[model samples]
Target: MADPAALSPLAELARRNDPDRFLCALFAPPAQREVLFLLIAFNHELARARQAASNSMTALIRLQWWRDAVEEAATSAAPRRHEVATPLAAALREGRLDAATLQGMIDAREVEMEEDIPSLPALLAYLRGSAGGFAVAAGRTLGAGPEHLAGLQALGAAFGMAALLRGIPAQAMQGRSLLPADLLAERNLTPSDAARDPRQPGTAEVVRQLAGEGQRLLAEGRARAKGLPRAALAAALPARLAARDLARLASTANDPAQPPPPRGLGDRVAVIWGGLVGRG
Candidate 1:
């Protein structure tokens, strides 16, 4: 278990907003764990930008602010003074994180603000940049070798797909749907209609197709992770949680309208078990 006193404010933020990563971080050595916390917390902040903003332009402005902050952090001795930025700047300076990859993450979120995803390939690209890219950064922070980074990203994408599917209900309430626009169109549904009610005909099929893709990615990621260093396991461990969610998705008949059950003791136990096994 992670000691509360040992967690920095940023790490606590990760614990509150991104508990799966937080639980996985506990398996790392203290210093690496702190970097993991910073990375995940930074991601949580990026994810919130769209919802926090009153309009699309405002959301772009918020993302641009983070981009400038990241640029400054990578080049300047005196980086921005924000809580997350301070340590993130230190990580950028220390080479524990990469500037271009971080930039790519920002780009992904910017794309996410769009209502139409166009195609399945385009949607996967967003997942690759956002979740998969973030995992690659975290894996590096935990001393994962360059060779394992691609697999780490794949693992993260799998987790991202699961997360996206599970959040459909909440996102719908907010007038957003991440489903591929083309897929929805084939069913004669618009993004707004799917957002309003995922249980409507053809919506469940979209969810099913996405869930199947998530499972495929999980398998490929697991195969690739077999070669990762033992120390890198925690960084990739969220795939286990993804697997569980993907499985539940099938049991629920792949209903996008069905909200995910809250994470409980079983979820934590699964992370612990995945950590022990050194596979996600």
Candidate 2:
């Protein structure tokens, strides 16, 4: 087993940077929660690589480092001695994780280093590659079988879309836009228009359309939940918050250009209740 002290930095990383996942981890099995935290922390590192990099090439280099780290963890008798890699290697040694899927998640962030705007199909594909892959890995760690992988991926995609929608303002600030090009074209808007200011006229419509698609996927994924193992439900907990957040974004009062309001007390209760009832 990995030392508890060695896992603290990963835990703190999750708590400070991804509170929704942090809260969800609280309900995971005690033995497995640390592994989940490690996985989520690794994801945060990959997702933020571009933002942290000095340039696009620098971001690609950072991603390559992680890719190599995961490859080593999978094949080496003794993995690299790094915070993220150490726990990840432990998970791999125990056969609780897959290196290929984790590598796929890392590879998917390649889009983040580019300035191109993806179409709706491309955007969904990217979500499946990153978030969907993460869900499947989390499910495996919880002892879910192959039968549950599809459902977990669907849940993850829904969660991913909602997350991308929530990130519009931040992405816009960086001059990046994840909104589908076709969707923007339909609104007679360009990627530059949305990237310059998400609050641009007709931008809300595009956001609403995307949020609707996210809600649809959320419903589809929830329908598949009945077939998933109860333990696997822990990996889907973020869907609870995603659902609430999409609803808020679709509302008239909410501004797409601003960060979504922080999760409230009621939101936390709902997330816990959903986790207990195996709803998300």
Clashes of each: 0, 0
Model 1 residue 129 distance off true place after TM-score fit, in angstroms: 0.5
Per-candidate TM-scores read: 0.96, 0.92
lDDT for model 1: 0.86
lDDT per residue for candidate 2 within 1-280, as digits (tens), equals 2344665788878887778877887777888888888888889989889889989999999999889888777575687788787888888777778888898899888977766656888777788788888888888888777876777787788888888888888888888787887889988888888889888757888888878888887877777655677776788888888888889877777678998777799789888898778777
- Summarize candidate 1's per-residue lDDT along 77-164 as a digit string, tens digits: 5878888988889889988888898999999998777766889999899998999998888888778888788888899999999999
The candidate 2 region of ten consecutive residues with least summed lDDT is 1-10
- Model 1 scores a TM of 0.96
Residue pairs in candidate 2 whose N, alpha carbon or C atoms collide under 3 angstroms: none
TM-score winner: 1
